[model samples]
Target: MSNDGHPMKGHRFVAWLIAAGIIAASPALADTPTGAARELATKTCAVLAARVDEIPGSGPVFLRSYDSSFGQGPTAEPALANAAFTYDNALAAIALTACGHRAHAQRIGEALLSAVNLDRAGTKGRLRNTYRAGAQTQRPIPPMGWWDVVASRWFEDPYQVGTATGNVAWAALALLTLSEVTGKTRFRDGAAVLAEWTVQHTRDGQGPDGFTGGVHGYDDAPQVLTWKSTEHNTDLVAVFDWLDRAGAPGDWSHQAKAARAFLDAVWDEASGHFFVGTTPDGVTVNRAVSSLDVQLWPLLLHGALERWQRSLTYAEGAHAVDGGFDFNDDRDGLWVEGTAQAALAFRAVGRATDADRLLAEVAKELSPSGYIWATRQPSISTGLAIGPSSATDDFRYYRRPHLGATAWAAMAALSWNPFTGQRLQPVRVRTTGSK
Candidate 1:
């Protein structure tokens, strides 16, 4: 079955139905956190692999985001058709690899590498923001360039294809893992290039606050530099560490140190939480934002027991509901990706019971046919934006199955680290590696 829970056509559909029936019949199989996670991962991966459109040289490109209003013309146009975001595909590759699907992981990795567009001047080995599966005369894919907000929104760029630090970090991590899994030098070479480029662009001591957050890629028009993301820098720390562990030649100590310094500068000591990030001018942004990812990511990747406890308490009290976690403290609806990610974080921090509970909550969002919804809502909304929104209370896209969310659910189930494709286990404070 497709992610929408609609019956897919072809032999794959029949196989999927049989698989789903088996899963549904055996409630015991779905009772355990890992069992349910593996089942969902296997089933979802099969369907996603079957449905994806393969580019000749690039292999399969998973859908980045789905709009329920797809094919509905006039005011509502299809925004994400044939478009694949690098970061989403990277995460999918990690999840598939963790689930023992090396072929799928390699396919995704190759596709990402094949889709690389290196037109931007400032950065080397920079990937395009998004890639189209096939050419379309009516609405050809936008030209590759630096991130331009006006052009992006006006043109309806679905994946916001640009040189985002976070996206590149993820892509690099994915490539490194693919290299390890496939023993291919090309993938490792690709990861090294990205890592080197990232280190070059990193802002170490230039900022007023002595922050190490990297610049937010190149932007067009005004050509003004934008804010830096603490989350993205944290991701870079993990990326460099993974590359080092994989025996890549680069000396990643400096980059890792810089990334950690940026994270430290952004840490809110009193609150026991890290701030969202710093603006271009070095001022902190989103101090009031209470997002699950903002807290969970640091805890999962960089272990801080006290901070993890505090963040977990905050997430549970402020963002979590019966179904899942809200997008932020201010938002009323749950975000499926964040919830699944939080489950992994819980497991990493030795709170297996909490992790299992979260996994169970996510399991409730899965269809009998094994497709997991992006977000489960009490009712559907009439908004055009994808996923949940505060204004319209629209849940159409939220209720639909999403590639990224399902992949994250699979990752959470295995207690897999997205950075290294390793099973998550609690660790004490260490001095040997990047934290």
Candidate 2:
């Protein structure tokens, strides 16, 4: 049975193959650079398409974000067995779009639309960070959870049910991407709803002046997170700008400017890198840590590289681990998702060789199960907490086969920019030694 309790049919694989453009009549896979990239992209899309095929009768269906590792058999990792993270699903939607799988992309898009219209505990326009991973058969859609036989109660992870600014912006980006690809107004309109919720709830005017971290629980009155994130603001800069370009009303240009201003404020002139963001005070810069995505994602903004290219240097210096990239400055291990993100950022800046180097690292992470590993180590510390109740910095990525990492790898292989839906042109290949 699917996550929504619907029985699935096995005949969908052929249709999925046709949608993925992998019919038998297709040209033979080549050995050159472009051919190699296409091969990687085709394999990655096949992984995603197989996930989409697991659900039936869906206006909105979600694919689980992570699968158990190679030796874990067919059972999902218990912690995230039913969790379809909005951010991961959004990345999958954009990756499918980039790979020319419109029908599959539309299924995830419909799921995002369903989330936008059906928050079980909040106002209609907002989305939780995650939902149950399957077809939406229940009204107001269900958040992810499982029965705890030991505790004799249903257990829900608080972080999964909370709203995060970055996650919601990613959802909007996915919707807008679908709108651009399919020319559908409903997708665009759904993105507009997300934009409105973000502006109304998370907008902050404190020190740096951008969106906050969003709510942090599953209650009707969830705890409002006062912390501001450079990463979150970076996501909104792309989102608000896209909305403005789509002729979405309601001062979207000014909103974009506000988000951009926040990014500008967080730039550290001395280190030439962005600070992680503000503390809970929302007035003081949180210099306690560094994040890889915070440094690279902003570079994808239109014309941002021309102004903030130094951030790339900073990332190389601080986050590079072995041959790949890590999640934070400690550089303890390879973070496959961050490595893929760095590849796309490099490609965007005309560093095709640099992009290729990172993609090679990403390719090493491919698992026998067709999904990508989340990290090189058996477990890697992020130096962060998983939820408000966590006692310490207990958050970590294990050696799981991750859907999000695979989607990002596919994007990097296709040279597709998730934020803008435009392909980055590859220039002359120049080897830039070690990171």
Candidate 3:
């Protein structure tokens, strides 16, 4: 999103100026963790909520991603036109709500709900992937697989669209959280619709495994990518757990049971860690790639403390960087999104000191203009090129200010738990209304 204000040159510059003023006005408070988090959240939230592109009647919608040097779309073509992802907007909604920007949160939530309805026109209430200018972009990018370096090619196809289980689950979480915040049944109902669609379309039953975790979702031709994902299943488990706790209408326990079974099937008892995903034929992918998400999610969402500790230990040895965590075991440079996520996960598992250290490192990556880099480097080609030439491409890469990284950073700063929809500091609470 362009940060240009009517009188101001750009939003980034103005945001930095405001942040400087806040720091200068209260140096002591700014030095403290609470103050630092509040400052970072305020600055990042402002940039995230900036209206770079304004639709005729809808007013200004949040830009999906931005970068001062590279511009938008460094990662995907649609981002260049400021195409908003349903998942990214959901993240913004949750972060905004947690940071006490209720009005901003409501605006994002409503827009997303409208987008969902528009996309669900013929699907009988299934949520689609993305919305740009109030219309669904049926041809959206699939989920990013940073671990498999050649995976970028999968997203290069413009005709490809996916209803990723993780995306759907996250959208449901955001809607459910928004419902709690606003006392709006519409948001809850929207969440239920997504949950139902996930149950009907994503869950696989033919395999020996009870639930095939979940499919990679569907493409434009109504084709399903039959790979079952441990990460996506973990996400569903959290989603169902949240729904169960919220008293929302759904067979959450049943969903969670199947999801847990999928997770158990993928778990490597010897290593005490979960594999990435399994193909329809049951061949495992990404077994060698040490995924930060795989390491962090079980602990953060499922409360698997022993496994969490083991995974953390493995990650530190395999993917640790100077100030942040790598995207995977092979990658040398830090993945900004993964780092921010690791920080929150650390706090969730009672590693406050470790979380603080990681957050400090992540803060260093923030630009003077108040944006977070998607990664420390432009490309992760170095690590990806290590294997045989036939295995992967040696493509160059670039970095940009990613909305997902910025959102996670804000959530980490505020000690907000995305999985449980609770704050980590002082003590965890069931509802958003509590401090």
Candidate 4:
């Protein structure tokens, strides 16, 4: 975890130093997060931070939320709980693999594969909270209302639906990340399913202007509303980011076209921040309140920030105190859900200072027991203590994959590593007649 001789540091330094060189025609790569913040950003916080009590027969989970005293005894205790909702697990999967923990990544990958099945309707998996099958509700097409959180991951919706945000895109991203680590075609095949689902189901929720928000079109009806928001923008774009990264065959360039079209349509030509879902009242919204979606877009697409340049309103206020993000607005200071997303965003646009500023705050709040403080309130056991600090608190994202997905959190941090593609150590292969 300390400064060591490695390629990641170099990569980190390069990304962090980007702004000093641009203000002209779109360069090949402009805003890249670099330096220690860049390096540490991608490193995984050991799972020792937070601890949780699991049910005897229940599946393991990463607890995102927990009690301060956490147990019957008034002692300052810790326990693993649940996985985070977003592609948070993906962050850990990528970083762990990057740091040479391919085996651990594979284990997490298996858990992910077992968690949900997107196969044909007759043979699908069940939703985490509800009993309805994942295949039934998430197939042939995606149900749009699934992203609404409280909608219940599973319910006999008789109507069927999917959450477009992480639901539609993460399957592909996770599969791709797995493929990169293990080079397995099955993972790629799964990723393909993700691609097909989004390609066809795209218009399911999108309105006339292209960008969309809300449940899938009710029985493929006419475009009833034109809503715009970060969730709509990022999920759709990520589907393209995957296709782009997956190197899928055929002339599917239209995905990018679709991506850009949607981006331009909803890009607020004025202020930067993506709004809350577009309202039925045609309200104007552009605030710094955007969620993980805003951060993921640019991080996934190198030239994505340029989409903002077309109007001079893309994260303009960025680099501000909160790096233009409002993590502080929530009262718990930096966090796993919100700030982690912001960390990804900051790294994407080469905001090393901002990335560090945010991480530094979070790191300071981390407990030595390996738990990133679950929250900055109540017991002061925020449970997210894995950054640049040496604090102790046994409430880490590990041990709880169901509700607390630390894998992706770890991955996002490691992605900021200065040395992503290269191995820190040497590897040798046997030749036709060697050894």
Best prediction by TM-score: 2
Backbone-clash count (model 1) = 4
Candidate 3 similarity to native, TM-score: 0.77
**Candidate 4: worst-modelled 10 consecutive residues by lDDT:** 21-30
The C-alpha local distance difference test score for the whole of candidate 3 amounts to 0.61
lDDT of 3 by residue, 1-435 (tens): 212212143345655547655323322223236644555565555655443222323332444545445422254444334445667777877877666666666777766565455453255345445545332223321222223255544332221134567777888888888888788888887877777777887777544242333322344435455667777778788788778777788778788777767766776757766777675454454464456777777666644535435667677777788678877666667787788788777787678888887777666556543567677765553222211222564532346666677788888877887777767642232321100
Local accuracy by lDDT, each model:
0.60, 0.79, 0.61, 0.38
Tens digit of lDDT per residue, candidate 2, span 1-435? 112111132125434556765532222223115644665666677677667866876467888877743423233644587678889999999988877777888999998998898688657778888888888778788878888888899887778888999999999999999999899988988998999999999999878778998988768557888989899999999989898889877789888888888887898878889999888898899888889998888878764735467788999999999877889888888888999999988887878788888887776666656677788776777777776667998888777778899899888888888878766663222233110
All candidates' TM-scores? 0.76, 0.89, 0.77, 0.56
Instruction: Please identify which of the two predictions, 1 or 2, would achieve the higher TM-score against the true structure.
Output: 2
lDDT of 4 by residue, 1-435 (tens): 112223354345334334322112112112324553333333223341112222122232222332232322232221112213324344444444554555544544454454445422332431121122112222322321222347545322221232333353554555566776687866655556555544554443334233433333223342323345545555555555455556766334556456545554455545554443444432344343433335344334434554443211233233123322332223332234445445545555556455566554433323322334433333222222221122553322321112222333443455432112222111122222200
Residue 376, candidate 4: alpha-carbon lDDT: 32
Scored by lDDT, the top model is 2
After aligning candidate 1 to the native by TM-score, how far in Å is the CA of 262 from where it should be? Answer: 1.7
Q: How accurate is candidate 1 locally (lDDT)?
A: 0.60
Model 4 TM-score on a 0 to 1 scale: 0.56
Ten contiguous residues with the weakest lDDT in model 3: 426-435
- Compared with the true structure, model 1 gives a TM-score of 0.76
The order by descending lDDT is: 2, 3, 1, 4
